[model samples]
Target: MSLSLNLPESLPVDVLAPDALEFDRGPTVSVPVRSLRLGRSPRTGGLNDEHCRMLAAAGEALPPVIVHSGTMQVIDGSHRVRAAVLQGRQEVAAVMFDGTADEAFVLAVRLNLVHGRGLLLSRADRTVAAARLVTSHPYWSNRMIASLTGLSAGTIGRVRGQLTAQTGPVGTRVGKDGRSRPVDGSSGRMKAYELLLGDPSASIREIAKRAGVSPSTAHDVRKRLQAGEEPVPRHRQVPPAQEPAAPERAVALPARSEPEREEPADPEAIIAALTKDPSIRYNNIGRRLIRWLDGCRRGVAECPGIVERVPSHNIDSVAALAREYAHAWGEFAAALEERNREAC
Candidate 1:
């Protein structure tokens, strides 16, 4: 039941913890330069030399870097550590963190995002990383990916759709909440069939509703029971329900023609296949982008740091360009997704 990432397990932290505990920040500790492990940085681009130089001049006055408790590898404050090294310091301040390696990487991304260096990755690199993460973490939603990468959810959704379409179908059942997990729907179907057997007057639709399956599937199950076939419940995770008691009264069923060969369509599978088309994916991305843009407009949301940073010269021009670029991003990601789907 552990959730493992496709990351190197060389670090001492747990690579497959089922759930990462809430992050705990331990008091600052000083470690010798020789003991420090320059942790693997997830930054797409290289470190900013100018930013490091500035931090070096500031010396130990800057905040301590964060390190994994077990591995003693630096997770944040890479530049500060570098600066400390340049300052000929034997020891630097660090705050030890206790968490899984995946959580450590996520924290690193957030730290790099707003610490004057901006995002440590280019937009294209970020997009690729986002798609890779979605494919690896099927249980994760687009919002979860966005939270870790600080990328738009629209982009994450497009990437996820592309990956799903490319891979055909995942074995696990995907629910409306966009999470995939093994499900047992069999016991409920068996119970429903038993109920229908006890009471010939029971409605098929009601049986289907109680069983949490499609009406057509319920009909098929009923037909099988009528044909004197012992019910073999499908092995799936079924919902909690009261076990149906076999009644003292049993009714004989009418003999019917051979059961129809038509199988009930799984709504989840059908929707996934339907959305594999290029046009549909693009339309989805565009709609989400438009919604995000609506919130970005002045009146819709509070002027965040991004809006505050708009240059003084030709304010409207920059705003217009940003809008166009965003629209273009939506279009590009959708089209790329379409290509991947077709390849699959």
Candidate 2:
């Protein structure tokens, strides 16, 4: 799930701030409940007494609470902490989170959304949480905040508009992959065009660095300029008075209209065809490859059912692993294609 960028050596590498996934991976320890301070919770109504009783009944089976190491503030699992107290436990298991209070709060919202055992955050609560996040993490893209708050990106976008109207607009947004991209790429494109006019010989990476855009974008600008076309694509070119709200709409509409474009070959048909090949059917390596491909196809086909069966608590971890495997498979496919090209 990592993206590679040809960024300048002077630019710092971006890493996601401490989040629920990081908290899940952190080491657990016994922290005295008395020593922990109750941090601000995302729940609008605060802790539910009935939920605490339910967790208390689970006794020692309750999972570790997440605590901010710096402030000794309870970042998540407040109900679990209350439950442990009702059980007369002196200390509860905890995972220490070393991050700012704002980051800890964001982690709390994310953990509450993902965990199955506790009462989920209400829609109103989630909306409030999303609004707070828009203020705290102004640079975070809508999808990134939406993923944490369990809201749609569109909802988050609306929330951002309402919140930022008072706070002012952000120039850049940091996406889930932790890369900061310009909110309005038109400016970046114009900058790139200017750079190209000054020195057409400049490398794409260098031009991108100076123009504050991605290398791919700089390359596009250079190509467009060379062709005597506008540096910014027509769809992306917005009047200075208006915001570029739907730059992708123009490009996306044509894709739906042209539905007659050929679809990919069916995986089952391909596998069946490969199985019938004499050279493949009789060879050990070929048979193994066919079996592997078939297994993958089956796995992909059953993804909906598989997702339904995944335990709620483990869903985040499972999804992360699945994405990692899918990325690896993409790399494997690319390598095999390279080998085939060499053979040809």
Candidate 3:
């Protein structure tokens, strides 16, 4: 035989709050305990036993859970039921609320999301958070968020990428009147975006002005473009003008000079000295003697002959010395001639 248990009627949770609303109560709802209804989804996730134990320990009445009427979906407070069930609760108290499926989905997600807070981020919440940040603080750019969060600038950039990406590449550069102007080759989308974000007074026109291009040009180039056509190369934007080369100058030749003959110094003096002492070294001569003979040889052929310059006294002195050493030599040429004549 099974023990009979009495279960109270299910409570309905309204979207609008009746008495008071607190964060602990989960999403606010309208209606009393008597009018509450069961949520179709019954709220999922938060299925841990620890929460159930805590709820059981509290020994307090259950707070109301918000829900949508049409879909009977749980909008918030899924964990409360899970906790109660885990604690062997016979009856789970809840307040019913009325809302559309979309509203209920958002509310339920926000409620369960804030509970754990450490789970992997949901796509909807991430998108909502990003949208909220961008809308509330217009000055905060993706790069700024990336910087603070230590995420790649590209990551944050891609988050809000399509906002500016949908427009044509040329749209961002076009002026109000729709004319193309020159843009700085160095400017990038991130840089331009930063410029506008930093100064609220800045418009597309201001950015175009700083970029040194017409508003239209900046507009067109700045907008996102498709993959088909190649970007108009900036290098070809302006044709570089060319100038004529300077005429060549005539270089004059240097005049020719008479080549002087390089002669040995003191030729005559060196010859005479060598004759007197054939065994002597030439480098030991005095500088004056070298210089004097070198100067004299400059026009030696033009000078008068020196064949008759020997004095009789010097010749006689030289003959007497020769006669004194005659006995030390072989027969003289004159003696040989006399002997040949006698033989003839």
Candidate 4:
């Protein structure tokens, strides 16, 4: 008999409840100790001998072990089973779990993390358990795995990064609410933007459904376009190098003071070289700096038209703001030079 058990709604705020597990929580049944199989234990160092001895001392007071109904494998109470054998017991009380082997393993990890009066799983053991779960349940979100393994969500995220480097990225993940969402929503937003542009009269829900995004995201995209902004926000947008050319005209800015060279350096070539460096390209701060620099490069190239478009009354204010930005950049460059000298 299959029983559906939804994760309790009373779980702590940090924990993300997973989808329901199938099990039989009916009356406990007696199963012969010798007939039971020892299932996989999340404990990398194996069962604690001291824990089994303590349980053995409890005698008949021992609680029922949870066993997988199909395989007669212990899912959550390996120590109890061991204690029963030590006590020369012919049979022990057991609750049946009707889930698959994978599900049983997951349940085992969850129980180990939360229950038992014995030694809790060590950090190494929990990490190993999380790594295994990442492999077996790629769709499970970091918080979901974190809740089960008793690891922080950030730790689980790092584990996911290391493991996925080998297995490749999971396109979608099941959120705490049990809904699957795309790992990256940029594509969905772009699609929604296109749909909205193609049919301005279409309902937000219709656009969202076709674009594979939430209705709220579709509405946001529509609002952004209406305001004459890009469909995706700046931080969330694709790298500047990959974006399509803007309609603004390009005009080279005045050259800065530098030592004479055989040939003038190409700013585009310099940017491309910086992008190829993994230390800069992959680092968050480095990437942000690159984006800023690229923006400045574009701004300088469009300055002629931008200057002409400035209203006569606001020109002084805009020029003052531009000078402040240039001063800030100069200070930033000097700081870098000072750091270089200090290193030397």
TM-score of 2: 0.56
Per-model TM values vs. the true structure: 0.44, 0.56, 0.28, 0.57
lDDT of 3 at 23: 32
lDDT of 1: 0.56
Query: Sort by lDDT, best first: what order?
Result: 2, 4, 1, 3
Candidates in order have lDDT scores of 0.56, 0.72, 0.41, 0.69
Q: Is candidate 1 or candidate 2 better by lDDT?
A: 2
Model 1 scores worst on lDDT over the 10 consecutive residues at 15-24
Model 4 TM-score (2 dp)? 0.57
Cα deviation at 9, candidate 2, in Å, is 34
lDDT of 4 by residue, 1-344 (tens): 21223111111111122332222233577777777888477877777677587667754465567777767788767887888888988888777766577777777776565453244456677889999999888998887777677777778888998998676888899966688988777788878877877899999999999998999999998887676666666555557776543223322233444442212224553565455434456569979977988887887889988888999999999999999998998899689757644533
Cα-based RMSD of the predictions, in order? 16.4, 17.8, 48.4, 19.7
| True-structure RMSD for candidate 1 | 16.4
Q: Count of backbone clashes for each model?
A: 7, 0, 41, 0
The per-residue C-alpha lDDT of model 4 at residue 296 equals: 76
lDDT over C-alpha atoms for residue 276 of model 4: 42
